[model samples]
Each structure stands twice: as C-alpha cells, then as structure tokens.
Target: MQYSTKTKFFNKTLSVFMTVLSPVILLTSVQAKEQIPLSETRCLQKSGYQPAHKFSPEIREVTIGNQLFDSIFSLGVKNFSEYKAYIVCRIPVNKQSHNTEFRVKFGIKDDANYETAKKTKVTFFLDGQAVESQILQIGQIATQNLEVSKNNNISIEVTCTQKLYTLDYCPAVEFVEASFF
Candidate 1:
C-alpha cells in the first residue's frame, strides 16, 4: 500500500518517541519501590565504667566538607575502652506464600577520626541472627540484600575499640541512614 508524505513523517516520529521513552518509563517504574525506615528502636550496650550512651532521636543536620547529611542517630562515646550501639527496626512484609528479598541501604557518618579508628566494625542482624558484618571507616556506605520467608526485625550493631582510653579523644560511630526496599 502507498502512504502520503504526512503519514510517513508521523510514523517516523512515533518510532523515535517510543525508542526514547521506553527506557525512561522502565527506569522510573523500577525506582518507585517503597523504602521502609528502620531506626525507631535504639539500644546501647552497657559498659562497666559507665552506662550505655543514649540514642538521639533528633535528626541533626551535619556538614562534612562539601556534603551535607541528615543523621537519625548520633552516637558519641568518650572515655571508654570499647563501645557498642544497637539500632533495631521491625520491617513489615506482605504475607505471601513465597519468600521475599529486600535491599537494605545504610551508611556511617564521616568522622574526623575515621582514618585513625579503622578497627570499628558494624554488624547487621536479621531476626536476632547475624546477616553481614564489615569494618567501617569514615564515610563508608554499604548495601545488602536479604531473602526471607517471612517478615522480621533487623538491627545494626556497631562495635569500636579505642586504642587509647584517655578522656581526650574517643572513637565514635554515627549511623547516617538506614532504609530497606
């Protein structure tokens, strides 16, 4: 069949539009997943010398160099040989017959002494079971995917041992962000 010049131009335009729009639509759809927050319950390990540090519920605006961050928990422990902080959050899941996978994204705030305190370790637990653990430095960001048959609670525990127990300067760990999709 023969077509007019206007029809031919419209067909070409439609083809180009689809080629450019397909990936954009797909990307937007993929990025639209709901992110659940897991920073409601905070627990700190008790120390022999002093009681555990309190978890600050107030979100503070922090600026490190050129980057700015909103931190939900700021844990600063001073005059201690070892410190531990725990952040527990319960994640709700759909009651499906099959298992589900969730992507957890979290980061540690950038500290001035992060380079000196390289021995700080952060462990992630799901349903009171250890899922992943890593030694974190300043400005370290991490992501992990967990597959479970049912919904459960998750926690991030940070442990740091200071080389010097002086009251001058102590190592600190700040939880900047924690969300799951």
Candidate 2:
C-alpha cells in the first residue's frame, strides 16, 4: 500500500520524538535510583541521637529556666546516597546569667522518639566527659555545630548557675537546613 507524503512525514517525526523521549525518561528513572556512597561525609551517620522526626512545628525556639528544653522534628529521610546532617544551633546568654552550662545531644529514634544504637558520631565541644558517660556542658553560648546522619532527634540540656538570678536563662536551638549535595 502506498502512503501519503503528509502521513509519512508525521510518522517519521513521531518516531524520532519517541526515540529521544524514551531515553530521557529512562535516564531520569535510573538516576533517581542511583545510590552513590558518600565519601567525604562530615557527619553522615546512619542515625543520630534519635530517629529523625518528619516535621518540626517550631523550627526555632528558646527554653526557659534551667531544664532540659527540647523541640523534636523528624526528617523523612529514608536513605541517603550522599550528604550529612548537621544541627547548627545558636545559644544565647542573658546578661546577668553566669556563662550558661548546657549539653546538646542528637540521636536516632526507636519506637518512640528515643535514642537508639544507630546514633551518629557524637562530638561534644562545649563540655567535657566526667559528669555523665555521654554528657558535657560549657557555661557559655558559643555558636556551635553538631553533626548527625540518617534519622536524628536533637535536644539541649542546660543548667544555669544560680548566680545569674537576674539574668534570663534559655537554650536557643535552630535547625537551619539539610544538604545532600
């Protein structure tokens, strides 16, 4: 059977378009599943101190009194190909308060928002190891950065000195953002 010129041209163009589109679609699908092991992982632990929460209502908040004030947020990170999680927080001290002493911890969650073995490499900069097996505190609000991986729940435990009676004491924590590139 003989075909019209217009029909032949249309079929040729459609075939060409499909050929190009198929590869692009396939490539995209393959790329999406490609998992590259992160080499230079600053803090790409499978899990942090707690299972990462999916959502955090208050991205940032300040706690009052000398107590363990915490805000939980879960990052729905099933698995990562590359990149690390960091809890970059800022602590502020009230003028009258003695350099506030506090310890910040991050971990992965179990059934509840509890700590698990799949925690990230714990790095403490503010305090030292003496009081608790995994606890440290420095009486100061020195801007600090803590690293974690996988799913992590973060909290800051503080103990303000009584001397700072006139000063307002609180731990200011802020989850800046995450990067996988």
Candidate 3:
C-alpha cells in the first residue's frame, strides 16, 4: 500500500507525540499510588521560632526516624526551640490525593514548660477548616485521621501554645509521624 505525502507526515507527528506523552502518564500513575510524606514537604510558613523542621529533644534523625516513628524526615515546629509555635505545611495537588486520608501523630514533646504546664491547646486545620483540636500536656501525643478530597491549594496548619516556664528550657513542637495514604 502507498500513502499520500500529507498522510505520511501526519502519521510521524502523531507517533512522536505519543512517545512524549507516554512517560508523563506513567509517572503520574506511579506517583499517585505512593504515600505523601508531610515531614518531607516541611513547613511553608510559620509564626517564627525558626524553620518548622526543628525536631524535639526526643527525636533522633536517621535515614528513617528512629525506634518509635517512621518519619521520612524530621519535622517539628521551628528549629528555634520555641516553647510556643505555629507552623503551616502546604501540599500542591500533584502531591496530594483527590480522595484519601491524612494520618498524623504528634504532641508537646517540649519539656520546657514542665513546671507550670499551663493549659496547652493544639488545633489542626485542613484548607482553613478546623478538623481536630486537643488540649494536651507535656509528653502527650495526639493522632488524627482526616479525610481530604481537596485537589487544589491544599494546606495543613498546626497551631499551638507552649508557654515557657524557664528561659533556657525551650523545646520545639514535634510531630512523630504525618503522612497521606
């Protein structure tokens, strides 16, 4: 069989386009099935103590977080060792699920305010909507599983109170684990 010159050129262009499109489609599928690590995403903005990657005193960093948690990276509020801190983490749609659960566990790993132990409250928000809030004490850890379906400009905000009892005893707020699966 013989083809016209126009038909021949059209066939070649379509072939090249398909080749380019194949990799992109495959990559997207692979990434969608994977877990999204909140710690790795880190904090986008914070009510400044430092960068929100400051792990608490009890946290030890390794390729994977130590004996207790499976952290992809060490993530805590402000590396400044603040007694009180607020941090925000955002996940671009490419990194989030259109429908899935955000699972997390954290607490006031700070020993700084052990003496006064004033009322400590932690609130979590998903896209500016309060999903969970808890009144916690030092050494208390809280866990949450939030159902998220947002596919655009998604974000997680962590707000807490960590009144310092002593000048030198400031501990950063820490999250042992946070992931979307």
Candidate 4:
C-alpha cells in the first residue's frame, strides 16, 4: 500500500487535534455536572421577615439624598418595653459538605435625642445560637461573621429591648448589608 504525502500529514493533524480536544471536552462536561449556585446578597424582603406596623419589621428600600440602598432591615418598636424581631434567611447548599460564610452588617439609626437612641439592646443569632449581643447606640456599626456548615437555615434575630423613658420615640435597627459567600 502507498500513502500520499497529503494523506499522511492529514492523519497526523487529526491525531493531534483529538489529543487536545479530549481534555477540553472532558473538563467542560465535569464542570456542567457540578452546578454551584453563585454567592449573592439578598434583601430582607426576599429573605422573609415578619410584617409589622405597615413599615415596621419590613425591608425598607429607601434613597437618602444621592445614596441608594435596599438592604435595610427595619424594626420599629415604640414604647418602654421588650420587643423582638426575627429576620430569617435560608442559605442554599447543594451538598452536605458545602460550607457557607455569612457577613451581617448593621447599625442603629441616629436620633436627635441621644437618650432615646441608647435605650435599645440588639442581639444577633445564627441558626439557633446567640452569636453576638450589643447595646445599640448612635454612630455604631456592628458586623457579625458566621461560618455555616452543611445545608441549613440561617436565622437572624434582632431583639430591641427599650428601657423605661419619658419621651415618645420609635427605635429601629437598620441592617446595612447581609452577604453570603
């Protein structure tokens, strides 16, 4: 049998092309099999919070001046008593071995009357455990970092306990951002 020079060159080229393309196709198929949800930040409205007082316990999307924000978790409590607000969010996990990290940033809205602002106590919880607690005051921003293992629900409870006071005021805790990665 006699093979032409062009046929020999074509056979070699085909062999090289198959060798290079095999791994690329295999890699693509493997990646497609494992579909991981992208990490993202969701608003409190989407995450689910109990509704209260028209605006209380609602995710308030507001534009202040030129700044735009939609992550504010507001809880309006008016009185000198104990008030608790729970903001629960479920993190998506495809497998039991997957670990997710959550970052919760929040602050107390400043009030003209400093005494009214300092009368609130806020506590943060992960799952069902008390992770962090603080006496929320004006000009204070707090962050809670939690590492969640396996697939489970993440519940954030913001309990605002107001002390006995004379003036009438409604205190609220504004969540700046809640990010999961």
Candidate 5:
C-alpha cells in the first residue's frame, strides 16, 4: 500500500513538471513565416500571361466572397480588350522543413455591378512548369496548394479572352489570402 501511494505521487509530480515545461519548449519552436508580395515577371512566359501588367497601389485587407483575407493584391481597372494578369512569387525555402508549400485563396471579386470579372482562365505553375489550370467564375474562388520545388518559384496566371460567351466586359481580379506556409 505504501509503495502504491509513493508511485502515484511520483507520477503526479512528473506530470506537473512536464506540463509546466512544455509551453516554454513549444514557444521556442513556434514562429510565423514572413513572405514577400507577388510581382510581375511577364506572368512567367507567354504560355501564361503577357508581360504588360500592373498591380493595385498597395496590399490591402479585404472582405471578399464571405471571407476576410490579408495581403490581397489586385489589378487596376482596364479596358475590355484582351485581358490577362499574372503574379509570380518566389518563396524562400527552409532547408529543414520537408513539406513546405505556398498556399493561396483567390478568385474573381464577387461584384454584381460588373466591376469584378465574370469568368477567367486561371493557371498555376511551379518551378516554371504548369501544374493546374481551371476556369475561375464569378462568386467563386479556388485554392492552390503548391508544393515548393527546388527553384522555389510559384506563378499564377489569370486570363480573359473573347471565347467566353456570356460575359463581355473585362473585369479586374482580386488575389486573396496569399501566404507561404
């Protein structure tokens, strides 16, 4: 009976010591990854987008499509001619982390007044190779979980052409929730 009571006491004391020490250890490992904003690189060749591109004055916090996102960059309003936009972000690789990725939530801004694009062609490239391509429509957004390649470069290309039947006006697109994790 005495042995059992001593064993229980020892276990409780060890548990308390571990509980107190865990936070200090965990805090040292926890960190936020700082990422740079996207810029134009001719959308990474003609296969994706044209070299002529422009961006919003600054990165802004925007509430779009029922979600609040940070570091949102957008293009200025332009004419309804041939429209294509692109963003190329080169992520800094952490050699220690194995499964690093560049994650982003983006879509055409859901604007009813036609300030936002109705539909556009979106493509993703990793390490200068096409990985995913799709049509991003109005009131909707898509996410790309791009794994970091050795080059650590990820490019996003959004384009609009005359092929789309319904929507005639060329509207701007909003890039939301861009980050590296």
Candidate 6:
C-alpha cells in the first residue's frame, strides 16, 4: 500500500530529531571532566647539627585505610650534645583535610631499631605548652613544632585524622652552632 504524505513527513521528522540528539549526547559525554585527588607544590628546608657522628633511623610509614599516620622516610642525628633535637613538621594542604585532627608522638632512640626511647628528656609542645598539643589532631595544613633534648638520636611520629599525604620532605630536627670551650 502507498503511504500518505502526512505519515511520511512524521517519520522523516522523527528520524532527523533522533540523528541530531544522538550526536549531542555523544559529544557531551566525551567532554566530561575527571576528578583527581588534592595535591601540593612547595618545599620546606632547615639545617642544624646533631653530634658529628651520623645516626640514621630507618623510618617507616603506617597506614590506616587510605589515611597515613606517619609521613617519615628517615630521621638523622648529628652533633648530639651541642643543641636540642627538634621536630619541625610541615603539613601541606593537599595532604590534609579541613577541621580534622591528628596526633604526633615524639620519641628519642638510642639505637637504630627504635625499640627503646629515652622518654625522660622528651616533651611535647603545641602552639606553646609543655603538654601534648591537640592542634594537629584536626584537619588543616599547619606546621607543628616539638622539641626534645639532644639525646643520642631521635625520631618524630606523626598521625592525622584523615589519610596522610606528602607534598615534600625535609630534615625533622636541627641543632644550633656549638662553641668549643
């Protein structure tokens, strides 16, 4: 049977509509954006003496799910008696969350194994107090400073509320210039 003009026109219109719609859908899908994790771009630097004899500790990173508690690769000690051992931690924004807290434990090690630490000469300060500070327990990029007496050697333990991330690495502790009497 021969088709009517009205029916033929309707079919043609529908075909053209679908042809145009399909390409728009495909093009829009191809232009979709991707989601990526937060990142940082900066470096922190500091210098100090230990004891002249170098003590390198094999530091390890601890992870709890996607979050990392410690971001240490290694800790070094030199000129042990000249100055106090201090841990200067720089938390980059890309590696931290807002309004979250993290805990950092400081310890002094006499051996490379980090089995026993001299806890007597160790003290933690947050902002400016002798007690364990809670500033790092939450999420926010900050620099936390903890000081320890220059024992033989030592390392700082860092932990955070969210997954620990790294932007850069630097010395954990430094010593002041000593005068030979």
Give the worst 10-residue stretch by lDDT in candidate 6. 172-181
Candidate 2 lDDT tens digits, 67-112: 2333333222211212223332223322333223433323322222
Give candidate 2's total backbone clashes.
20
lDDT of 6 at 171: 19
Q: Is candidate 3 or candidate 5 better by TM-score?
A: 5
Q: Which predicted model would earn the best lDDT?
A: 5
TM-score of 2: 0.25
lDDT of 6 by residue, 59-169 (tens): 455332233444333233232333234443322222222312323332222222221221123334433345443322112223333232222122232222222134222
lDDT (tens digit, per residue) of candidate 4 on 1-181: 9999999999999999999999998976554223222123221321123443222233556432234455445544544454456555567563543446766666665432455445455665566677667666655666777776553566655544555565454455667676655
The residue-by-residue lDDT of candidate 1 on 16-63, one tens digit each, is 999999999898666544555544333444333455564445678664
Q: Look at candidate 4 and give me any clashing residue pairs.
A: none
Clash tally, candidates in order: 0, 20, 1, 0, 0, 17
TM-score-sorted candidate list, best first: 5, 1, 4, 3, 6, 2
Overall lDDT per candidate, in order of appearance? 0.58, 0.31, 0.53, 0.55, 0.59, 0.32
Model 1 stretches astray by more than 4 angstroms:
1-33, 39-56, 64-66, 76-82, 96-108, 114-119, 148-151, 161-164, 168-170
lDDT of 6: 0.32
Backbone clash pairs for candidate 1 read: none
lDDT of 6 at 67: 39
lDDT of 5 by residue, 1-181 (tens): 3568889999999999999999988986875555533442223322223464443335666545766655366643233445556666556655444436667777666552454445666778887788988776665667777767465677776666434444445444567766565
RMSD of each: 7.8, 18.5, 9.1, 7.3, 6.4, 16.0
What local lDDT score does residue 149 receive in model 5, on the 0 to 100 scale?
46
Tell me how candidate 5 scores on lDDT: 0.59
